[model samples]
Target: MNTAAPALEMTGLTKSFGTMRALDEVDLVVEAGTVHCVLGENGAGKSTLCHVVGGSLVPDEGGLRLYGSPYAPRRPADALAAGIAMVHQHFSLVPTLTVGENLRLLRLKNLPRRVARVRDEYGLDLDLGARVSELPVGVRQRAEIVKALLREPRLLVLDEPTGVLGPAETDALLATCRRIADSGHAVVLVTHKLGEVARAGDAATVLRGGRVSGGGPLAELPPERLVPLMIGRPADSLDAGLAGTIGLAADEGVRETGGEAPEAGASGGRREASGPAPRALRLRDVSVRRPDGTTALDGVCLDVGHGEIVGIAGVEGNGQSELMALLGGSLAPAAGRVELGGRNVTRAAPRERSRAGLGVVPEDRLHEGCVPPLRVADNLFLGRLERFRRYGVLLDRRAMDRAAESVLTEHGIRAGGPGALMSSLSGGNQQKVVLARELALDPLICLAAAQPTRGLDIGAVGAVHSRIRGAAASGTGVLVVSSELSELLVLCDRITVAYRGKLLGPVDPAEPDARERIGALMLGAHAPDSGAESAVRTAAES
Candidate 1:
């Protein structure tokens, strides 16, 4: 045994914001040439720990060491100079620059050769000339990873790196992580997904409520042990068969992996298709053209019935963005029609759409859903402020605050009252705020939610699912657009898969092969290959 100090180590690290503590006496150690997985639910101090190590935030207590020496970094530059590189879950690329230009900013000589080597080694196919703004979300995420790897740091930290990747991309990235670790570099992966941990981790550290619940060799602690550590309860307690499946154990008594999808619906189980329900939302031959003159969505036709939940599932950037924009009324269709509750709303403005009982939770919550600079109270009543007018001219501030307070409480939002800034809330809490506002509208027709639970923890995700289901139960049609297959499998009565600007299948949820069928459709397997496989792979790796 080497018996040397760890590549990196933290002892008694504690951090706080206001009265709440984000981290408390947290400790972690990473060995060289090893992949260490940090497991935790949201707000469990996982990101905070990464931020401290990456020099984005300073801890109020405790200390850190690198290679047996005290290490304290004041900023990202300091950490980078100390041979540490971190790829955040949210991309940090300059939107205006090309991929080639972004790599050049790292100030490394032989950049092209390095990039080419990484692409070959990591199974990535990125277009250097593509503008960051022009690329899809998955492509931009790949660019971020490439940028970080260009540094060739001794210590690499990836915060939820696979969140944006498809299954193939995720496997490739995990293989790349192993290769990096084999070369004697330390790797720290912060993630909530148990499958990834089981597949790639050499060591594991589980965090719950800002403290370490368990830490040991990955093989020693299976998902059964890790799940209880993460949520303070057994996996079966949370959901049926979650523990065994998560652990990849031999005994999967409840559901088969890659087997038939369950034959059930939301909370109340499967509902018989009552013939010919009223259409809550309808799109006929809808098409969207991007500024670059590319057809984002082409001749797409879909509809949702009143009192039903329909899920849209596909790999990221498979016309999902275009579909969302069209549904939200932010983009006018180039051809065909959009109808909300049997009325033609093809050219209706966003405000008009909202007024006609359309509620939307956009994919990008930070930029589109809520204003960071505004207080929670103001943001809650953002688009529908006219209702608060008292004398037809004067605004009623008190009424707004009162309404905000009630919604906040009803949504179980934990904040510094309604006066708290939207920027100050955590990602999960920010999502709750968005949900509170949109759902409170009590829309008559349909509620379209795009990536509603993208970055939430298990607990927060459960809450969001319940609210969406509640809307459907209340006779409001619900359309959920998500990249998380598990979420779609659980939440939707029917699932639709999109590929290459084409929509397929309101596949019956009761069908045993629902997931398999949808996955095939998502990859455009039913029709003769339109080269979408190659394009989607390129999108995944870019």
Candidate 2:
């Protein structure tokens, strides 16, 4: 048997975009039988490196060795034809089509027909006819995997694979990735989760500022050591609030200069929460039906207290998005009461909701949070533009700049100019703009969806978390729905577990039955029979 070269190899790779030097002379080696992790912060050239490998971009300069031979892919098709499949953070599956149909559209010969029989063979809960849009986030991710595997690639590159997935979903996906590696296909796992490095990775390469910061066996260094190398500095220990915000330490830092000073974690010491609490939000027996007529939320209920943070934790796709929309006032409940700050506003418009002291950080921030073409200051006050208008006459640039500058100072959001287009920012800074706009509303309640900090570095993560906790401490009710358990554990005073559209129960973080019980409830290991609905009722009363 021929002792072949590694499945994929790249040496002295470099690339730049305008003044932004995205990638600098980076090297990588991937063996066929092991999972290789590419680590870095957002804008750290991880994506640039992948684009170079996948033929999405012709490198300004670099060389590639594929399957032991010099190879240069002229285009994405060239890479695909050579058996290199890339799955990005965003799913490529067609939302309007069923999983089965989307798979067929890839034209992998008989792959579509074969999907029906052994769809679960890859370890994801998937249905053949389920449309990608109708399917939950986890299942949609599975469709992406199925699409890539259909081509039977010798090498697979997954960018930010676990960014959308919850803990359970991530663990299951990692196992499937390992199986693929064992089958002699090299897999490149790109992620911000340091835990994933220790758990699923066979080998890891850390990239910082467009350069390889470090590389070794996954077991060689602990998280502390690995973090500094990735960011070119020692990781700072933020207060508890900041840690949870930035998707843990891995994403807590890495903010661009002129960006908002990220919020720090709330003081770890618990405060005695009190009342006569100004009302923030209220929901009663909310039920939502899917387009396929399936029930996503069944007679569910919830409430957010002013100046408080109520965190919702659940497995991925357990009515969390539905809950967020219902609160954001985008989707109406089939039967329920919706109230905003002591006002019954079930039938109110989204604009009305915002007018009534409600602000939201959308799950898909790129689309829902900011307008791509809008200026940074304009985006920051997009929802509250009325603040700039006087007598319904003209646009006020000075007032807008003043508002943006205030948010920048308080929240430390960075941007080149108030007139800089929203799309010009890196992800973390863009998120800061979103937060600045919403928080500046001084709303009674803030409904934050998934709030994608998963791929950010540690300092950024800490800032976001700290802001939420700070809001709560200051008495702005926050309804934070996240698939991240660590976030719930650290930032929330009380956490409620939602599973498959049912509330297991709301438990105090200080209670003896906190972590283990919450985890068990999340997995449906054991859920208390009563009081789940009561949490919602209590919110209404509050």
* lDDT on C-alpha atoms for all candidate structures: 0.77, 0.71
TM-score of each: 0.89, 0.86
Stretches off by above 4 angstroms in model 2 are 1-3, 116-118, 235-278, 373-378, 386-430, 525-542
Q: lDDT of model 1 at residue 79?
A: 96
193, model 1: CA deviation in Å?
A: 1.1
Query: Where does the lowest 10-residue lDDT sum fall in candidate 1?
Result: 533-542
For model 1, give the RMSD to the true fold. 5.2
Give residue 26's lDDT in candidate 1 (0 to 100).
89
> Ten-residue segment with the worst summed lDDT in candidate 2?
256-265
Best lDDT goes to which candidate? 1
Write model 2 residue lDDT over 311-357, tens digit each, in one string. 78877677777777777777777777877777888888878888777
Candidate 2 versus the native: TM-score? 0.86
